[model samples]
Target chain A: MALEGELAAMMAAAQRGDAAAYRALLKACLPVVAGIARAQGVRGEAVDDVVQDTLMTVHAARASYDPARPFLPWLGAITRRRAIDRLRRAGRRPVEVHDPLAFEAEADPGPAPGAHLETRERGAALARAVAALPEGQRQAVEHLGLRELSLEETAALTGRTKGALKVNLHRAIKALRASLTREGE
Target chain B: MAARHEQLVEDLAGRLAPVRPLPRPGLRAAAWLGAALLLGAVLAMRFAAVGMEGQAPADFQLAMVGALLTAIAAAYAAFVTSVPGRPVGWALLPLPPAALWLGASGLGCLRAWVSPIPDLHGEHEAVGCLGFLVCVSIPLSLLIVAMLRRACPLRPNLTAALAGLAVAAAAATLLAPFHPHDTALVDIFTHAVVVAGVIGVNVLAGGRLLTRG
Candidate 1:
């Protein structure tokens, strides 16, 4: 209720082109946007771009906002769209290949290292693993493991047989594990 | 070279700013009008196809039309008033309407379920309502990421929006089997495409506006 009223006032001020109000609204919404971006696997420098785009969008579309409705969801909807768009434009570049499995695996309760340090180590290890794989194996792992394609799907995508795909996946996973383990040691 | 990089960043920062006060109201209205026409054409086609079967209600159909228009208008107003510059603001403006459309469409479908309509059975109606929500949601989620990009200018909103859209598309594919065979896939695919198109237009418009501005 009180929050809603404050949001309404802020929104109203923003609508009237009050830069301060616009900034405040954006400031308030930043964490939400950032959290969503990070959750969707965006990181480092790209995070800032995603946030900027989201805020610019929100500010640009401020006037069309109805005070009668909730604001966060409206803001959230825009953030999600912008993030997806950024992802598409970036293409399938090697630098953007953050391991989704490692990301998930690292999220659980683990050893005593600082979260940041552990994440960096894991990330570096994962990068090395991906770099070390044979081209065909790397491609298979990238599509099947990182991108979450199933064996059959990966086979279809790569024009390999089911047997060949399993072999590729097995070798890829084994190589990645060995590489990561060596890095850790 | 350092100065050049700084200047480039500054220029990009400026270009990425949310508020673009349009010099001419007429141009703003025309841009919005074009958006409306595009939406109307899609809706008309949807209604025409549905109407051919003669199963949908006139009042319900009218309500859907009205809701879409209102959602788009509200969105435009929200986006325009919030931002400061022309082109950037204008390009980023369609997000609000797109969001509203999703919300209203979801709510409308939900409401239809609650109403005493005897046409769709319990399971089918539930599936339809769920399908509509999911269809609209995929885009709404994408739009939210887009808005964040405009707000921060740190990461490109396009990346976030596409990644989110791709994820949503994948999720929808996974869920497609549970939905009704006739309308479910078509509805979701169409909604996704429309939402994607809207985002694409916003990006193109922003690019043009940034260059011109």
Candidate 2:
């Protein structure tokens, strides 16, 4: 209820052309939009660009928004589309890497009680590895590993054929695994 | 130097602001003019046809026409809102006229449905329903086309066309009255499906054209 009231107030302010309200709304929503874009494998300088573009689209189209509806779905749709647009512009190729650690992360259910520390440590290690990847490679990993784009979609967006994207993605995964394993040891 | 974090946040916020102003010159005028022309044509055709029939003027016809035109305008306003870079000003502009249309139509339909007048013939009723479907479908399809044109980067036309078909099918299902007659059922299905297919084809072709480099 509080969230709804805040959103309604924010929307009302936005309608009144309140720049502060618009800025507040954008700032509050930024992390979620950024996460969605990152999950779609967008990386580096392009991440900010995609987010900005999505925000612009959202702002320009604000009047069309029905205050009666939930905001997340609309935001998600814009983020997803913008991410796809960035991928298309970049023409990055996909890579196919069989990283046991990454696959394990997906396959494992919730961490066991005693394993919580280990899980946290591993997650931290993975985050550092992701942060450390070469800009291009990091993007490929994020797109394939996090966003779960099909090889075809990844290729189409990046202008790389399936084989090329696979190669790049493999290299990215190998690097991430090596970094994590080193941290583990 | 201590305010660096705040500065960064402010900078990011500024960059993310919507850079494009609402487009004002030609496009807005075109949209409004187009809407006006459409409403005028619909009204003219209805009145002209009714006069030619040389039968007792059914009060219901005016209501039906009024309701349809209002719905069309409302739907169009919705489209304008949905379009990227469109001003908020356009949003409210279309509503008053639409509300008037809806009010007139609603009253007419209600009166007709409740009146002690003899039941309309099966054929006439079917024709009326079909007319309603077409009136609703065409504008809605156009609205979808307009939206797609704005949203799709690769092939606006094709996207618009496909979007139009989808909109038509969905609108028909929700808005058209269901009847038991085989002919009515067939007509409904046929109209819905055909509109969908036509719009899809138009969008695909438009996309190809737009993207051809």
Candidate 3:
């Protein structure tokens, strides 16, 4: 494609330390990198983080590029790698679940008027949401989120490795957040 | 977010300086191979002076050829894999030659088993051979890893492992020309252990060096 050729030319020039060409190339790469993150299932503000991380990686690795080869695949690989890294970091962190698995009792009554009804409706919606998840995701949410089991315990109970459980938990959280956001809207 | 992205682009462009791209993977690999061969030749000469006097068996010759090929293939693979977006499958290029080396060496062991002869060398000589392998591998591994660091490898551990394999194969091949003992159980075991240690160290340390933070 003409666009790929143009980008490759820009990159070749950028490799020679042409500042304007480098700037143009990076600015052009932003949308492509962001789109790649979305295609790889990175969503929301995290896509922006992936785009930034990928640009940095591209800068660091520019010397490795072969001008004789097409540039898009090289860029795509770096973007995907950065996107996976973001997903892995996100997976490793604790995810919040909507259901009330723990309680910290306050001396004062919680809320007034229809607040209890609203809370009950939200909890019911969350329960339905969890039920609708695929088996692995649902189990991950239950063992890792609702029950608050350690990763080791969850793996032991579910017969999944810790890595698999983490991936499932990450996917479940993403699905729930999307579903809940749509419902809220 | 847009402002931050713009600022980042500007900063990166501003910091940019004239850069020389790395040579093609094959060319870089050849350079590494040249250095290895030169060192191997020197070591072979030195080893011949004090080593046992006997014609090497056909199996030993086959093992040496396999080791040489392994060194070339693995060195090329390491360079290829060091570049971002290259096929990771390049990492497996050395496997065939590596298998041949192992198999040929194993045959030597089997042959010895069938025709129980006196041991080729005493325990101290075996230990000396081990020391030779480890010492020779150190500089070779360092040199290859240094070359690899020029390119940013997404899979640093894999690239480093390949470099370790290349260096170990080259050093082991060098030992063949003047090895004081015939290939047997102890020699095979020693080489295997040394090779594994070299690869392990590279994966742990060289991987860190290749990572661009």
Order candidates by lDDT, high to low. Answer: 3, 2, 1
Residue-level lDDT tens digits of model 3 in A3-112: 78988989999899999999999999999999999999999999999988998988888888888889998898888888988999998886654324533343346578
DockQ of 1: 0.02
The candidate, 1 or 2, that scores higher on DockQ is: 2
- TM-score for the B chain of model 2: 0.38
Per-candidate RMSD, Å = 26.6, 22.8, 21.1
| Candidate 3, superposed: residue stretches over 4 Å from native | A98-185, B49-54
Task: Give fnat for candidates 1, 2 and onward, in order.
Answer: 0.01, 0.01, 0.66
- The candidate that achieves the highest DockQ relative to the unseen native structure: 3
**TM-score of candidate 1 to 2 decimals:** 0.30
Global local distance difference test of model 2: 0.55
lDDT of 3 by residue, B59-95 (tens): 8778888998999999999999988778889998999
Q: Determine which window of 10 residues in candidate 2 chain B has minimal summed lDDT.
A: B176-185
Q: How badly does each model clash, as a count of residue pairs?
A: 93, 16, 0
Worst 10 residues of 1 chain B by lDDT: B204-213
Error (Å) of candidate 3 at residue B212 is 1.8
